[model samples]
Target: MSVLSAKFGHRICGLKDGRLRDIKTSSSNVRNMEELEAERAAQKIEYAAQVKMEQRIHNKLKIVKQQFNSILQSWHHSMHQLRGKVPGFV
Candidate 1:
């Protein structure tokens, strides 16, 4: 049968065969709720850490790109200078 049907059968057998008891759930729910809240808090912390890491990586990449572009521009300038378009090294 389906999962729900199987679970229902188990619950029924448990209740009828003295393997389980009829009990109130009010006393046992706080722990589950607390665990769920803790999980959410942990997820938020993990997400913040990930965002910080991504920001740092983006900043590094931007700096690297700027440095590369500056080097390329300098190389172009020197090549043009050697061709005598300008008689000075800029």
Candidate 2:
């Protein structure tokens, strides 16, 4: 009778071992999914920040270009006045 009980206990443990391994694998998969989600969120935040920085740089460059064009126009007008004052200056 004792020998039969020991065999039965061993069989139960064997079945439980397979179930335990499956549970551990499932837990590991959940952890990996969570890590991937966190990484994706971080990447999104970084991309937003980069886009904002690019927009700021573009706006600043536009302002600088406008100022440069204004200065060039002023210089051109001054040159035209000087040319008019000179005799036979093409």
Q: By lDDT, who's the top model here?
A: 2
Span of ten consecutive residues with least summed lDDT in model 1 = 1-10
Score each candidate by Cα lDDT.
0.68, 0.68
lDDT tens string, model 1, 1-90?
A: 112122211322244434544333343464565689899999999999999999999999999999999999999988987878755645
TM-scores for the candidates: 0.62, 0.66
Q: Candidate 1 regions off by >4 Å?
A: 1-25, 85-90
The TM-score of candidate 1 is 0.62
Using TM-score as the measure, the top candidate is 2
Clashing residue pairs, candidate 1?
none
lDDT minimum window of 10 residues, candidate 2: 1-10
